[model samples]
Target: MRRARVGIDVGGTFTDFVLSNGADGSLTYFKEPSVPSDPSLAVERGMAALLDRARLEPGDVELVVHGTTLGLNAIIQRRGAAMALVVSRGNRDVLEIARCRMPSSYDFSAPKEEPLVPRDLVFEIGARSAFDGTILARPPVEEIAELAETLKSRGVAAVAVMLLNAYVDPTLETEVADALASRLPGVLVSRSSQVWPEIREYERALVAGLNAYIHPLLERYYATLTRRMGELGVAAPLYITASNGGALSVDSARARPIDTVLSGPASGVVAAARIALLTGRQEIITFDMGGTSSDFAVSKGGEPEYTTRTDVGEFPLILPVVNVSSIGAGGGSIVRVDKHGVLKVGPESAGADPGPASYRRGGTEAAITDCYVAAGIIDPDAFLGGRMKLDRAAASGALERVAQRLGMTGEDRAAQAAEAALSVTTAKMATELFKGLAQRGLDPRGFALIPFGGAGPTHANLLAEEARLAAIIVPPGPGTFCALGAIMADVKRDYVRTVRRRLSDDGAPQALAATIAGLEREATDWVGSEGAIVEATQLSAEADMRYAGQAYELHVAIPAALGKTMAAREVGELFHQAHERLYGFRDVDSAIEVVTLRVRVVGRVPPIAIPELDKTATAVEPKGRRRVFHRGQWLDVPVFLRDRLVQGQGFAGPALVEQEDTTTWIIPGWHARVDAVGNLHVSRG
Candidate 1:
C-alpha cells in the first residue's frame, strides 16, 4: 500500500510521466505520443499507462504536479481567445508603443509585433490615478456600462483593464473591472495590478492582457483535465508547475495563467539544479533538446539563474522566471538547402504530427532526427526501446534529397549530408550558448553541461565538443526529466511593490520595512492557504535598485536579517556591492534608489531520495557494437545498456549507452564513468 506522487510534463511531441513511490522513493517513467489537438488527452493516456506499468491503482496517488505548454503554444501560435483592453483615456497605445524598440535595430524594414488587442478593441475610460496613489478621475457608471456593452458587442471573450498609474492604487481600476464584470457576465476580467503591479505601464498591461487572452482556453482545458482525473478516481490535489521553478495550486494557476506559460523549461532547469546539488557540482549548464527546440539554462551554486525580463513570442514578460534561452533546433528541426545554396537547420520544426521522416508518419523532409538515423547514430530498430521502430530507408531517402540539393555524389552522400547537418546544428547551438554565457559574464570552460530531454544526451557530446565545455552529466531518465522536476518542486509565490525613493531620503527605511512587512504578510497568507503540501516555509527578499538618474535598475538579493531590519545604509551597501560586481566600479558617493521590493515565499516539500547504484569493481561489457558516423567517417562503436552499468565502472569512447528513452554518445576523445547515483559523467581525455 505504497502511495505515489505523480509528476507530468506535456511536451510538443510526448507527454512524460514519473510516478515516485512515497515509501521507497523509486521512480517509474513513461512517455506517450502527444495529442497536439488535445494535450490533456495525452496526459490522461500517459497517466493511465504509467499507473498500469507501476502496478498501482489510481487511488494510491497522493499528489499530482503537472506542467504544460498550452498557454505558451497559444501565445506563440496566436490562437488564443479574442481579448479586449480597457485603459485610461490617454494611454490607448501601450501595446503598440511597447518599449518603442524594433525587433532588429539595424534592420529598418523589420516589422513590429502585432498587438494582442487590436486598436479597435481597445476601449478607453476616464478612470485615472496620480503617480502617488491619488485618484485623479473615476469613470462614471454610465460610461462603464457603455464600455461593457461595446465589449460584448465586439464579441471579445475577455477584457484586461490597465488604467494609468494603476500600480499606485488599484482600487479605482478594480472597481471599474468589477462593474464591467457585473455588466458583462461570463466575460473574464483581469486587472493590471492584480496580474502584476510593477511600475512599467506597458509591461503591466501586457501581463494582464496575456493572462486574459489565455484564460478561457486554459479554463476549458483544465476543466476537462480535472474531470478526467476525477473519473479516473485519483482523488489527489493537482498542482501546476510555474515559471519560477515552483508549483502552485491549480486554482491559483487558473487565476494567473501567465506564471505557468514558461513552466516547461523551468521545471527541467529545477531538476538540473537539484541534480547539481546532489552531485556536488558548483556550476552547470542545462541542455534540454526536445522535439521543437533546444533550451539552455545556467545554474550556479546549485541554484538556477532567474531573470525579470524574458520574451513570450513577440511580447515581453516581466514576471520572475528561470532564465532559459532557446538556442537552436531540436530533434525535429528541418534541414534544407536554401536557394542561395546554403544549408540550414530549422527555425521551423516538423512538430509531432508529421514528426521526422523516420517516424513514418508522412513527413518527407529531412529533420535532425532523420539525420541521426541517416548517419547511423540512432539505431532505427532500438528507438524507444524498440517500441517505436523508425524507418531508416525513409530517413536515408530524405537526407539523399538534401545531399542532391548540395550536389553530393559519393556513395556515402546521405551519411555525409547527415554529418554535415549535425555539424551545422551543433555549431548553431554552440554559438548561441557562447553568446548567452557571455551576456552573463560566464565562460563555458567553467561549467559542466547537463543534458536532458529525449535527444539531449544523444547530441550532448557534439555540443560539448563544439562549445568546448569541460564535461557532460547525463542524468538517469533524461527523457522524462521535466516530469521528475515537477514532483520535486516546492510551493512558491512572489510578491512585489514599487517604492521609488532614494536610500538617503527621510523615512526611507521605515517605508521599505513597511512595504516588505506587508508583502511578507500577503506571501505567508497565500502559502498558508495552499494547504499542507509543504513541510516548512521560507521567505527570501530582493530589491530593484540603481543609482539615481540611471536608466536601468539591477536586482539585488536582500539578506533576510537586513530585510527584516530594513537599514538604509546596509541595503545601499548591498546595491553598491552588486554594482561593483557587475561593472568594474561602484559609485559610493552616488545616491541609490530602491525602486521595487520583491518577496518570495517558498513552502518546502519533503525531499525525494535518489536511489544510489550498487558499487562494483567489475568492468562493464558492451551489449553489442554498431557503426556510427562521426566527422565524415564511420567508426565501429561499443553499445552498452545504460541500466546494466553499475557504479564505479569506467569506460572510454567511442561508445553508445542506450536506454529506453534516449541514447548517450561518448565521442572518441572523451572518457565516461558511472557515479554513485547512476549519472554518467563524461569528460575530456
Candidate 2:
C-alpha cells in the first residue's frame, strides 16, 4: 500500500489534479471545467473525480497539496470582506496616498486603483512612535474605546492597525489591536509589524489589510475543503502551495492567504526547474500558457529568483515569493486592430466559456487560434484530440475581417496578418521577458525556454525566436506543468524582523544581532512545530539594505552560519557586492543602512522520482500531409506522433509533432531532436 500525493491547481478555465503514487511512481491527471463565480465548488468536484480516476480510496492518499487564485481574485475584483484600517492620527490617508504613482504615465484618463478601504472606513488613533522607536504620542483610553465602538458601528468585519513607526517596535500597535479584538469578538485584526516589519508605512499596511481582508474568506474555504476531504475519508494534513515555491499546512495558509496569491505561477517555475535539473540543464526559462494569460520565469543553478515586492492585482505585497513573469498572451486572447488600424493581441481574454471564435460558443472576434487555423497549423476537427471540434470556416471568416482591416487579401494576406499579430504579441512578450531577466543580470541566450499550458508548445518557437533563446524543451506533460509543480513544492515559511541602523561596532550591531537571533528562534520554533524531520531543518537568512539617502533598497543574501556573529562591515560589503553586480556600479563611499532582517525556513518534503521514458519505443512519420499555414503560404506539412517518437530520434521542419494533449510546430529552417530523457529539443538549424 503505497501512499499517494495529490496536487490540485485552480486556473481561470480549468481545475486540474495530479496524483502521484510514491510506490510505483505512477502519475494520473484529471481536469474539470472551472466555475469562476465559486472556485471551491470546482475543486471539490475535481478532487472527487481525480480520486475515482486513480481507483484509490481516500484513506490511501497521504497528502493533498493545492493552489488557488481566490485571494488574487478578491483583490482584483474588489470582492473581499468589507474591511477598515486603523492608522496613526495624521496617516489616515495612507492607502490613498500609495507611493503616489499612477499605473500608466501615458494614459491621462487612467484612474488609480480603488483603495481597498474607503475613506470612511479609515479610522485613526493618536499613537505615534519615532523612527528611533521612542513613543511620541499615545491616544487616551476613552478615545480607543470610542474608535472601537465606531468601527463596530460601521459594520467592519476586519481591521488593520498601522501606527506610525510601528515597525520599529510593534508593542503599542499590538496593545491597541488586542483591545479592539477583545471588544469586537470575531473581528479579524492584522498588525503591520506582524505582517511585514519593513519601513515603508503604506506598503506594509496594505499587506496587512489585504491579509485581513482575505482571512475570513480563506478560513471558511479551507474549513470546507477539510470537511469535504474528511467526507471522502482522507485525514492526511492538507498542504497549499505558496508564492515562494513552497508548501504550507492548511493552518498556516489560512493564517496568511496572501502568500499564496501567485502560487500558480510559482508552481510552474518550480516544476520547470526540477525538470531542468533532471535533464542536465543548468539554466532555463519556463513559459506557461493557460486560458486567460501566459506566465514565464527564469531559473539558474536550479533555483528560481525570489522577490519580496511582487504586486498582487494592483497592490504590492511584502512577502518573499518566487519571481515569475506574466509574459504570454494566452489561448483565449481576442485579436483585433485598434482604431488606429494597428493590430493588437491581448491583455484582455475571452476566457473559457466564450473562448475563441473556433470554439463555436458565440464568439465573433478573431483570436490567435484563428490565425493558427488560417495558417494551416491546428486541425479544425482534431482539437482536444477531436473531442471538441473547432469551426474552421468561422475562424477564417473572423480572420478575414482582420485581414481586410489590415489591408490584405487571400491566404497570403490572412496568414501574414495572423503571423504579424503573433509576431507583435511575441515581441511584446519577449520585451517583458528581457526586462525581467535584465533586472537580475541574466541573459536570455543562456537559458532554455520550457513552454507549457495549452498554447505554450504551439507558440514556443515564435516566442523563442523573438527572445533569441538558444533552445526550447517541450516537457512530457506541458499542459499540466503548474499542477505538477504544486505536487513538487516542499513545505516552507519565512520570518522577518525590522532592524534599521548603520553598520558599525558603535552603530546598531548589538541591536541588529539580537534582532537576527530573535527572528531565527521564531523561525526555528515555527518550523519545528510543523512535524518535519527535526534534524533536517534548513534555514536561510538575508537582509534588506540601501545606501543612505537612496529611496529604494535591495535584498542581499546572508549565509545562516553567520547568524548573529556577522560583523557590521561584513554586512555592508555584502550590499556593495550585490549592488555592483546588479547595477554595474557600487557606491563605495556611501553609508549603508539596514532596514530588515529575514530568515527562510524550509522542511523538505519526501523526494519525488523522475519518470523514465521508454526509449525502446518505435518512431514514425506523419500518416499524410496537410495544407497547414505558415510564413504567409500553405505548405504540405509532415506531422509526427510524439508518443511514437523515440530517444535519439530527430525530425525537421516543416513538421508538426502531435500529442494527445498538445501540438508542437517546428517552423521552417529549425530542427528538433528527442533527447535521452524524451524531452523535445527544438532549436535553430
Candidate 3:
C-alpha cells in the first residue's frame, strides 16, 4: 500500500486506530489502553503499533485525523483554564439569570449549576450594539484599559467578551476585546460573534466562555500529540474531527476547541450515515457503546440529525452538533446494587486504569465487561486476542457482592446477577432510545440498529430484541468504527444570528436578506481559511421561526440558491412547511417571527475507499464453540473468527463472531450474513 492515512479516536477506556492504505483500499485496526492522565501517550503508542501492524513506514503516512472527547470532558468536569467573562453593562447577571428558567421548576431542592465564570470574575462595560447592527455605545478606552489591568492582576488565562446584542454586529465587541487583549498581552481572548454569534445572550456568552475555558487545555494536548507524531518521523498533516461530523484544520481546532466537544460521537454517527448511503438503509440508529458511556444517534435518509440546542453537562451548547444521546452504561461502567437492593449498572465507570473487574487489573467492582464475562458473551481467554488475560472468577466474585445484596443464592448466583445487570442496562438503553426517537415522532421498529464500539456488538442483539428493532448491522471493524469515521469527516462550521422581526412587516424581508448575506460572507471566509484540503465548499441556510404567539421556534431550511434575493413570502412558506412536517399541521394565517438565522459551511474532503471483501474465497468453518448463558440457561454456541468470514457467508442462531476488538452475538432466531463490504447484517429469521 502507498500513501497511507490514519484515523485515531481516543475513547475513555481505549484509544482506537484505523490505518487506510491508499494503494489497495485495505484497512488495519489496532487499539491501546487509554491513559486518562496523559491521553496523548496512548495516541503515540497506538500510532506506532498501527504502523507496525499495517507494515507501513511512518514516512508513508500522508494524513492523520483524530477525534477526542477531552474538551467535552474538561467542560463537564469543570477542569479547565481560569477564565473571565466580559459583558455589556447592566447584564452582569445574564449568566446567572439564564432565561429565568431552573432545571426543574418543581424541584425546590435542586441546586443551580455554578456558572463557569463566577459573578466576581464577570466584568461589564458599556460596549453595546442595537438589533440592526448599529453601535449603541462603546466601552470607554479608559474603562477597557482598567478591566484589562484587573484581568491581568487576577491572573486569568483567557477572556470572553459578549456585549448586549453583539450578534447585531461584532465590530464593537471585537474592537473592545482587541483593546483589552493589548493591555493583557498573553491571555487568549474570544468574542461571542467570533465564536457562535447566536442570539439569546446567555447561550451566546456561554459559547464564548466555554471556548475560552477549554482552549489552553486542548491546545496543550494538540501540541503534545503533534510533537510526538513529529518525533515518530511522521510528516502527515494532522486534522481534528468536529461536532458537526466533519474535520477541521489543526489551526481551527487550536483556536476553537468548543467545536470538537461532541466530535467523537459525531464521527461514529457520520460513519453510520455513510454506511446507510452505501447500503440503502435510510432509517438506522447508530449504537456507539464505548468504555464510559454508550451513545445513540439516529440517521434518516442517510444523514444524522443535527441540533443546536444541545448541552455539555449542565451548560447549554448552541453550536450545531450531530444529535447523539448518551446511555449511562458502557463496557467500563460499574455495576452495583442500589440502596433499594435493585441491581444498577452505572452512572460511573472504572475507566481504563482499573477498567473492568475481568481485566485482571486492581479493580474489585464489577463492570459491564465483567457481566459479559460472567454471562460467557465474551471469551475470557480471547479478550483483546488474549494479549491481556481476564479472570472470570474475579468477575464472578465481584458480581457476588451485588448478588448477595440482592438476596440471591445458588451456584449460578453471580450469573443471575450479571444477567439482571445486563437486563437493567438494556432496558435503560431501550427506554432512552424510545424517548429520543419519540421526540422526532419516530418508532424504533422502523429503524435498524447499527452497533459499533468495544462492546456494542456483543450487546446489540439484546438491545434490539428489547427495543423491538427490525435488525442489526455490525460494521466490519466495529471496535474501531469511530476511528474509521474520523477519516471520512469534512471541514465544517456553523454560524447563527437572531433576527427578531415579524415576517409580515414590510422592512423585515430586507433586514432578513441583509442578515443572511452577512452570515454567508462570514461562513465563506471561515470556510476559505479551513485549509486546502477542502476541495469544494457548500452552504446550507436555515432560519428558526415561530408563529407570532408560539413559545418555541421551528427551524426551517432555506434554499442556498436563493441567496440574498430571498423574499418574505418564501421564508414564511418554508417555516410553514417545516412546522407541518414536525407537528402534522401548519397555521398559514398566523403571523411568523424570524427568531434566528443559521448558516452551515461544509468543506468537502476527498472520500476514503473501503476495502471490498475477497469474494472468491471458499466457505469458512466454525473456529470453536463456547457455552454461553442465554434465556436463563447455558448452551453451547458456535464461535467463528471474524477475519475468516467471507462475502455472502451466512450463519444462524446463537453464534459468536470473534474479532480482536469485539464480538458480535447472533441471538437465537436471528440470522447473520456478510455483505460485499464484510458488514455483518443480522435480522430475525
User: Highest lDDT, which number?
Assistant: 1
Ranking the candidates on TM-score from highest down gives 1, 3, 2
Tell me the lDDT of candidate 1.
0.92
Clashing pairs in 1: none
Task: Quote the positional error of residue 241 for candidate 2 in Å.
Answer: 0.9
Q: Give me the overall lDDT of model 2.
A: 0.82
My TM-score estimates for the predictions, one after another, are 0.99, 0.93, 0.97
lDDT of 3 by residue, 247-302 (tens): 88899899888999999999999999998778779899999998889999999998
Could you give candidate 2's per-residue lDDT for residues 630-676 as a string of tens digits? 66567888988776788888988878877655678788888999876
Greater-lDDT candidate between 2 and 3: 3
Residue pairs with colliding backbones in model 3 are: 247-490
Q: Is candidate 1 or candidate 3 better by lDDT?
A: 1
Q: Name the 10 consecutive residues with the lowest summed lDDT in model 1.
A: 611-620
